[model samples]
Target: MSGGVDSSVTAALLAEQDFDLSAVFMRNWDTKDELGADGKCEWEKDWHDVQQVCKLLDIPCRMVDLSREYWLRVFEPALRVWERGMTPNPDVDCNREIKFDALVQRLGESAQWIATGHYAHLQWDDATHRAMLCRSVDRHKDQSYFLAAVQEPQLRRFMFPISHMTKPQLRELAHARGLPTASREDSVGICFVGQKRRFEQFISEYIPPSPGKIVDEHGKVIGEHNGLWKFTIGESSRVSGLKTRFYVAKKDAERNEIVAVPGRDHPMLQCRAVNTIDWRWVWPDHDVQQVLALQTKLGGRFTTKIRHAMAEIECTPSQGTSPENVVLSFAHPDAGVAPGQTAALYLNEWCLGCGTITETTCTADLQESASSEPT
Candidate 1:
């Protein structure tokens, strides 16, 4: 359960309903491993805390090692995009690689459905024999965007216990239930790759950081940047020799230089097409067909998100050449969308699966996927 309040409360709620549960913590990231020869680390502290929480709950807990799978499926892909100067979303990749893809395969003869602490909903239709991914009731904590790439069929066996629970209610219940993880703070930063500095350093070991040029919108030289991976579209920060603080407006992988704008005149970031949407399982027309046809029932005005926790901007989806390559046009303008961010398409409150953001009418990428819509 990761020894967090939300997960602790989730276990409590499920237990109260008389559901037999055996919780498993995925050891996807070994923070100590990331630390290398740097001696013991704080991540070990987190690991100890997770074990203690499992003990207090009196539930059987085991660690599932997904290190290799994660490396192959998520980290490598994310690294590829980042080196290419795209701001890829790792959270979305973790969902697909660990939650839906690996966990489902690992369940084997034991578990029926995979459960996580994510605030999202899963629905099944026996009549239509279909499964749907939906947004959580709590808008603030909704994680539908992170799960936009979830295939429709695999969702049939998925369960989200926190779908309707608010963050406050979950915390309060955790303490009342005397769950050991109740007091644990929400997790922040990278779980496997470590912190920003750590991940960047690790990446540099292999990718070989190349000093690049910083330029303005008109292709005028502005300053010098440390590395291409260090900057993302719409990111505001220091650039040596720049008179004013700048935001990354564009990145040219070919020249290994970033184009920055003095202010927020970043009208050049938007693009066309959201290619390669996928789900947990196949539904008819899932290939490249849904790109164009959303059955009349699925079509309409929906909020399409380029990243998580940001306000959902309005969009309308239409049939495309490929089901995976559907096109969505924004109803209003939104800004700062990076090339590798996942643009999740949602209907009402339901997460109708999602795809990697190959190219954007506005701009962005799928979570953590390079070939498949990563997010």
Candidate 2:
């Protein structure tokens, strides 16, 4: 339990049931370990809330220090990606590596099943004899995308207590039950970074400044950047001397340059396809093969989302440059598509799996023309 209202309500619901109930709060980050850091994560307050909830629920509770595991398994790998000037989702990694994998190992044979407040559903598939991950009833609060990287074995042992309810309904239930966290605001953004610290400032402590050039579409240097990590694809560049606004079109890691274009809707910002690395599928091998076969016979059959809360967009999956990779061809051009972002796949409401984007095919014709022009 993250000491949040959702988890607190989850504990309350389970306590009313006949099963053996226990609450475990995971400490994934240690603020003291962050050398020369300004703001700290309110993990202590969260742990206090968790303790209070467990006391009210009358369940055995314990704190599991998984900070070392998280730093090695999730944060280090993410830092590598960031240093390469690509975006990485640490939350997704935390769900797969720390919560499901490491935490389950810690529990060993003591616990039969693991339950959480994740807004996703799990169903048994008799045909495949495996557990299938599904979307929650609350489409707006659905979090299946973050669990896409989790293996099927992990999904089998997982349960989502709040899968059937919406956010407001869950809060109402918590309030009626007199839960202490009923009115507590939901946590947002990255946990380690907290609510106050700027992302650039937090990341700068780890990644040394590698100043680079910000260039326009025609390869003209427009402004200077402190580091590639400071900018994100498709966001306004905020280049001061420019008469008009500029949006980040691309990040050239090899050149150490950020390419910015004149308007928000610039053609350069739109990507028609993306290639993924380290592709993983939650379905069985046979099931995945069948889907690929169907895709070959038909057109795009799967819908995909590159980030949470984004509407699912139709896409066609095919073999990428390598065996481990999968390339998704979007039905329509999508702006702000960037490398290192996970592309979660779904067949209607069932989340199939996801992959980290390694490359994007932005309006190819326009890119060729732009490159052909004189600098």
Q: Report the lDDT tens digits of candidate 1 across residue range 281-363.
A: 23444532453354455565566787776887777776556544555677766667666777776766666555555555433
The alpha-carbon deviation from the true structure for residue 305 of candidate 1, after best TM-score superposition, in angstroms, is 0.8
RMSD of each predicted structure: 6.2, 3.1
Query: Candidate 2 has what TM-score?
Result: 0.94
Error of 2 at 133 (Å): 0.6
lDDT of each: 0.69, 0.87
Q: Backbone collision count in every prediction?
A: 29, 0
The prediction achieving the highest lDDT against the true structure is 2
**Which residue window of length 10 is worst by lDDT in model 2?**
32-41
Global local distance difference test of model 1: 0.69
Scored against the true structure, residue 261 in model 2 reaches a CA lDDT of 96
Misplaced by over 4 Å in model 2 are: 36-41, 284-288, 293-301, 365-375
